[model samples]
Target: MQSNQANDQWFQSAAARDIHLDQLKRVERFNGRAAMLGIVIGIITEGLTGAGIAHQIGLGALVDGYAACRTQFLPFCF
Candidate 1:
């Protein structure tokens, strides 16, 4: 009887672990698909706007400011 109980417990533990792993795999696949979709959307946006992702999101000024400061040797450009 004790051996049977032990086998059942072990089987249940293994089944639980397998289920957990499957869930993790599904989540990872979803994340990968989402990332790919985001990249494609970003590419399309850039094509339409003629600007990179950073500029589209309003970071162009900061980047341009830094470049200007570097070229002009400004003491404080931040």
Candidate 2:
């Protein structure tokens, strides 16, 4: 927006100023809550299944039975 070239002070100032600790705390708090909820859902699902959830889904379970052999095939390689 300047007529001539200028330094990037505006963007730098926007990045550096720290007026919002409470907002940051709220963001972190919500993130933690979401993660905890996910864990609880995972635990409940595990309880529903007779066998416990493995660290990783077993190879046999992931590929053929997973989304008709198309979707989860690539993720299993990782």
Candidate 3:
């Protein structure tokens, strides 16, 4: 009887682990799809607006800041 109980516990733990791994796989797939969708949208927006993705998102200031920082030899500039 104790041996049967041990086997049952081991089976349950294995099943639970399988379920968790399946869930992780599903989440990873969803994240990958979402990232691809974001990239496609960015590309479409850039094409429509005739602006690069960085410019559309207002990263120009950030780029300029980095250039300024490089010239000034600053440790940190944003």
Ranking by lDDT: 1, 3, 2
**lDDT of all predictions:** 0.92, 0.63, 0.90
**Candidate 3 regions with alpha-carbon error over 4 angstroms:** 67-78
Better of 1 and 3 by lDDT: 1
Q: List the pairs of residues colliding in candidate 2.
A: none
The predicted structure with the larger TM-score, 1 or 2, is 1
**Model 3, 1-78: lDDT tens per residue?**
999999999999999999999999999999999999989999999899888777778997777678889898677876
TM-scores of the candidates are 0.72, 0.42, 0.73
RMSD, candidate 1, Å: 2.6
Given candidate 3, what's the lDDT at residue 52?
72
Task: Give me the candidate number with maximum TM-score.
Answer: 3
Count of backbone collisions within predicted model 2: 0
Model 1: per-residue lDDT, tens digit, 1-78?
A: 999999999999999999999999999999999999988998999999889877888999888888889998667877
